[model samples]
Target: MTETKKTTIVLFSGDYDKAMAAYIIANGAAAYDHEVTIFHTFWGLNALRKDEPIAVQKSFLEKLFGKMMPRGANKMGLSRMNFAGMGPQMIKHIMKKHNAMPLPDLIELAKEQGVKLVACQMTVDLLGLKPEEIMDGVDYAGVAAYLGDAAEGNVNLFI
Candidate 1:
């Protein structure tokens, strides 16, 4: 018998590549008709911003850091590991090779595909960011809300 897979992802990594992985996986899972909810928390909340456009810095130091650090969701271009110093370049190559859809496009796809995105309220309060900062399409909820979803017998993963 094939085991049914239902998942809720508590995404805590704000690194660019990590966010991308979560989004991509959620999209795929949703495509397969599984229920998916992504709970963005802590640093991961950075990826949900509406005003901040994710971009790679041009400075040599920032580029170097980009190689060493995680770029966050808006910037993840292709290394599976954000801190591996190959994230952006690898993402670009993978997108090119696979004709991968862009993040904005992916967001639309996920919406149409029934993927649910939730931003953690605690993170928002801690960051002093308003609810308006997050993209229009996402839902804002507290930890208890996340737990409520996780409690529904879905496979919960902290990614």
Candidate 2:
């Protein structure tokens, strides 16, 4: 019998391009029959956020944070040359012109491909993010869970 392959990625960056890279890799690994897990921590958790605002009550600080951070993948700024938020728009246009998948679409494809998408519970709490503010079909766990997945993965990456 053959052993199954495992791939685990720790997505720690909030940068749009970096998150796209992480999701692309996860999807590729899943296509190759690997057990894939993406651990979204800190700013990375933004990738799982819903594009629309959720009417949830929050502390003052929480509200401030929500206002400062991008609401979803499409709203996230690029790692470099953001140029007052025009960089992402230009990239999206280029991607569409080439028939390339956007970050949000890549994430959806990953979910459809059965790639495990996990949001760091601790990070969520720390960021004052409510479960209602995140998209559906995501698992919540802490560092220990991420470590366990990473331990079993033949390929491990931190984005």
Candidate 3:
């Protein structure tokens, strides 16, 4: 019997393009019959945020963090040429014109294809993000969990 090949990605960027790249790679790996995991940490957690604020009681700091961060993939900024946040909008327009899948759609597709999506528990705590702040169908785990996946992965990426 042969073991399945595995791919692990540590998505640590908040930029729209970087997040899109990570999801695209993960989807491609899943298409190639690889078990894939995308571990979202730090600013990367922004990609997994919900579009609407959940009605939950939060501490002052948590509320502040929520207000400061982008709500979801659509609200994310680009890593470069942001131009006060116009860069991501321009890129989104180009992507739409090119008929490419948007980041949010790519995320949904990845989920449908059984790619694992994990939010870093430590980062979540550090950011003061509650469970309701993130999208549904995501697992919360610590660095040890990510390390375990990466240890057996044939391809490991830090995006």
Model 3 agreement with the true structure over 1-159: per-residue lDDT tens digits? 488999999999999999999999999999999999999999999999999988888889988988999999989999999999999889989999999999999999999999999999999998889898899999999989999999999999999
Model 3 pairs whose backbones collide: none
Superposed on all Cα atoms, the candidates' RMSDs to the truth, in angstroms, are 6.7, 0.9, 1.1
Q: List model 2 lDDT by residue over 31-112, tens digit each.
A: 9999999999999999999999999999999999998999989999999988899999999999999998999999999999
TM-score between candidate 2 and the true structure: 0.98
Please report the TM-score between candidate 1 and the true structure: 0.71
Error of 2 at 60 (Å): 0.4
| Candidate 1: RMSD to truth | 6.7
Q: How many angstroms is residue 66 displaced in model 2 relative to the true structure, after the best TM-score fit?
A: 0.7
Model 2 poorest 10 in a row by lDDT:
1-10
Alpha-carbon local distance difference test for all models: 0.69, 0.94, 0.94
* TM-score comparison, 2 vs 3, better candidate: 2
Q: Pick the candidate with the highest TM-score.
A: 2
Better model by TM-score, 1 or 3? Answer: 3
> What TM-scores do the predictions have?
0.71, 0.98, 0.96
